[model samples]
Target: MTRVYTLVNQKGGVGKTTSAINLGAYLGVYGQRVLLVDLDPQANATSCLGIDKRSVRTGMYEVLIGAAPASPHILHNPRYKLSLLPSSPALAGAEVELIEVEHRETRLRDALAPVMDRYDYILIDCPPSLNILTVNGLVSALNGVLVPVQCEYLALEGLGQLTQTIQRVQKSLYRDLKLRGVILTMYDSRTRLSSDVVAEVRKYFPGQVFDSLIPRSVRLAEAPSYGQPISTYAPESHAAQAYDALAREVLVQDGIPTPAFETTR
Candidate 1:
């Protein structure tokens, strides 16, 4: 079965895009067919994986507005064994363009339907705000939502607002929409603040929180500059280990087996 999940947090710098890229990369490393949809207009996910967003003329924007087909817009990265539905700055205007379209909220779902069965996991990396684009992501999330919460003071507040948004989406948009899990990101074990934030988040989400916590690492931050996932940039690093573990947890949740495998360069 194909599992579709949207990584949403509304608040930026919470490792939402990083989680999407790294987690999806790890899933691919584990022998699963993975497709990462870069729904953010910023196109961080696209650039993070080494695709130049500046040159992407027709991508997710065209797919959403019915200007192009989803499959052809997909860019494959053999390095990570991942496929990306690249996004561009053009996607910034997609919301306004889609407003007049019928069933705007389901545009993503509709566009992704034909290719849904082509991959084992389709992870949508939503923008940092709750806009029409995010709404489309929420409605298209057939599996559920995966929120990456930063380990900081205001983490709870942001999560609460996102939960409310999820509730609203559940009631009005997609009833099957539910929180798949909360990923604790940017964790600094040396700081008491990070510890407290993790405890509080786990307390609130309880069983919905994943055990693998992503640490604040310099290497993780620099991976995107080189346009590679942490798994390929620093496979032996803590950040990679954490995301790999998180990917395993996600696979387990989906009743998939995680076999011991190594990436070939």
Candidate 2:
């Protein structure tokens, strides 16, 4: 079965694109065929994987509007051996255009159906806001949702609204939609606040938080500028190791076998 997850959080700057890119790369390293769907109009995930948004004439926007096929729009990342359905700035306008389209919410679900069987995992990097595009991403998620929450003072600020949106989607669209797990990102062990935030989130969600917490690293912040995932940009960095562990945990949770390898870190 293909495990499709939407990396989403209504709050911006929470490491959603970073987690989606690196996690998909690590999953590919662990012998899983992964396809990352860049659903955000910002196209950060597409650029992070070495694709220039300006050069991408056909992308998720075209597929969603029925102007192009999803397969032809997918670009392969040689570094991670993972495929990507790139996003462009034009996707920002899709919200208004899709409003009048029939079955707009499930457009992405229908677009991805033909390609679902081609990979073991399909990860969607959603936009920061909950709009038609984000709803499409959520509707296409077959496994569940993976939220990347930053360790900061306002960590739980907009979480209530996000949960309410998920519940509404589950009630109306996807009944099997679930909260897969919460990944704590940009954590600094040196800061006492990081620990406090983690504890509070764990207390709120209990068993839903992931064991692999992503640490704050300069390399992680730099990788996207060079259009590469942390695994390829700085494999020896702690961020790379953390994402690798996250991939293992995801596989284990899904009853999939993890590849055994000695860690260089």
Candidate 3:
């Protein structure tokens, strides 16, 4: 069965998109068929994979509004061994356009239904807000939600609101909806604050936090500008290695076969 998970966080710059892009890359590297859905209007995930957002005439907006089928809009990146349903800036209008559409929250879930079984994993990179777009991503998360929290001063802020939203969805929308795990990103090993944030997050989520701690690395930050994942751009970097371990942990937790972590070309 395909594991459909959404990397969601209302707070911006929490390494949410970074996590989605690299995690999907590593999952693909490990021999799993992966499709990354760039649901964010900013299209960071699309550009991170070397795609030009402006050049994309039809993107997530078209698919969500029923203007086009998702498969035709998907961009296959052979280098990364992954497929991406690229998003463009036009997706920003979808929040308003989808307001009057029936079953608006489930549009993404319905849109992805046809291609669900084609891949082993489908990862949705949601926008950084609790609007219709994020709701759609949450609704389409068949497996669960993966939250990337930064290790900073305000790391725990707004999480309570997010938790409440999840609870509301669980009660009224998808009953099976649950938090898959919390990922701590941008960890500075040299900072005492980083250690404090990790302990605090763990205490808050208990065993629901992922064991992988994404270290802050210059290579990791520079990869997106070059339009590449950390695995390919800096495969030897600490950030890349952490994401590789994260991919394995996700596979193991989901009872999928774990593949040997090999160097990416």
Q: Write the per-residue lDDT of candidate 2 for residues 1-265, one digit (tens) a residue.
A: 8999999999999999999999999999988899999999999999887788999999999999999989988888666879999999999889999989999999999999999999999999999999999899899889899999999998999999999999999999999899999999999999999999999999989999999999999999999899889998999999999999998889888989775633432
Q: Candidate 2: list runs displaced more than 4 Å.
A: 261-265
RMSD of 2: 1.4
Q: Candidate order by TM-score, highest to lowest?
A: 2, 3, 1
Candidate 1 per-residue lDDT over residues 1-265, each given as its tens digit: 9999999989888998999999999999988999999999999999998788999988999999999989877888887899999999999999899889999989999999999889999999999999999999999999999999999988888667788889999999899898999999999999999999989998998899999999999999999999999998999998999999999889888888776523311
Give the TM-score of each candidate: 0.96, 0.97, 0.97
Q: Clashing residue pairs in candidate 3, if any? A: none
Model 3: per-residue Cα lDDT over 80-177, one tens digit each = 98899999999999999999899998999999999988899999998889999998998899999999999999899999999988888788778899
Residue 208 error for model 3, in Å? 0.6
Q: Which stretches of candidate 3 lie over 4 Å from their true place?
A: 259-265
What is the alpha-carbon RMSD of candidate 3 to the true structure? Answer: 2.1
Off by over 4 Å in 1: 261-265
